[model samples]
Target: MKITREVVQGLYKQTGTARVDTDVAASFQVGDTIQARNINPTGHTRLPRYIRGKKGSIATDNGVFKFADSLAHGAGTQPQHLYSVRFTAQEIWGGEAPAQDSLYIDLWDDYLEPA
Candidate 1:
């Protein structure tokens, strides 16, 4: 089925009625170095395994959405900021990977901290 903005908004409106601290986005900007939090491996998570504890720079703001950590298990959709973070291949793989290669990942506000 084709999804529309109204459908997305309706979903959020129904599932994300709970409010959350969204001001965290104001602390980040493009090029800001951020470290992905090494959260305990448990339950469903959107944060990739390879990117845990890795440092990256904010590439873009992907706007606020329902926090996956909470939404995965019937918890209310606590809205939070999402951003595109760029990580060097060397940081993710190793020095032998490629000096100029990088990977971008979309991450939630709770999963990142100032590096």
Candidate 2:
């Protein structure tokens, strides 16, 4: 895979470590478990508008934790953590979503709220 400089920088921001490389790749499949927490105290991003306040089970693990680069405000990073948390659609979206519909998102350890 073609690694980029931004990806390398992203790892440093989340982990605060510079030992990582851009070529190091990691990914997750379905049915994997993970954790998602709220790091944003004042502002907001695209981390699921509803899941900001509640903690749910990992419905599907997708890929590695690509932390955002400090320069990019933690927007990108390399694949380090191998797991994704999945929350039930009903748990996050409420009764509006179908019973079978669940929300699966790939979040880094910093985003988890601690089960």
Candidate 3:
């Protein structure tokens, strides 16, 4: 992939989604239950430590996008679906936490799996 003048110009000229489109299959979907993968990478990542190993449900499919963790390390885009996941306060903070509350965060597919 060359970064020629036309490539830069074409990207800036886009009118629709700025998200990268790829054929990668969605690992989860809206309403699908998932658990954040427990990981502690020594490299750049957006996955928060608090969310790791916690259970949640997919609230929205935000579509495919480049993996920032990989990008930061000079790895390929590794495009995959990103989603808005909803976690109950109880689920995340345990039974002592308020049951009426919830926390929503966007996460990439690589950070989650079926719960």
lDDT of each: 0.85, 0.54, 0.92
Q: What TM-score, over all chains together, does every model reach?
A: 0.76, 0.49, 0.81
User: Which residue pairs in candidate 2 have backbone atoms (N, alpha carbon, C) closer than 3 angstroms, thus clashing?
Assistant: 36-112, 37-111, 37-112, 37-113, 58-86, 59-86, 68-74, 68-75, 68-76
Candidates sorted on lDDT, descending: 3, 1, 2
**Winning candidate number (lDDT):** 3
Candidates 1 and 2 compared: the better one by lDDT is 1
Query: Model 3 over residues 46-97: C-alpha lDDT tens digits?
Result: 9999999999999999999888899898988888999999999999889999
lDDT of 2 by residue, 1-115 (tens): 5679988888678655533444534333344343455556544343555666666655444444455433245544534543446677887767888989766565644556445
Looking at candidate 3, what is the lDDT of residue 24?
83
Give me the candidate number with maximum TM-score.
3
Model 1, which residues run further than 4 Å from truth? 1-25
| Model 3: CA > 4 A from native | 1-18
Candidate 1 collision pairs: none
Tell me each candidate's RMSD, in Å, in order: 6.1, 9.7, 5.2
Question: Could you tell me how far off, in angstroms, the CA of residue 17 lies in candidate 2 after the best superposition?
Answer: 17
lDDT of 1 by residue, 1-115 (tens): 7999988888866564334545544558888999999987579999988999999999998777778888887887868888899999999998899899999999988899999
lDDT of 2 at 45: 42
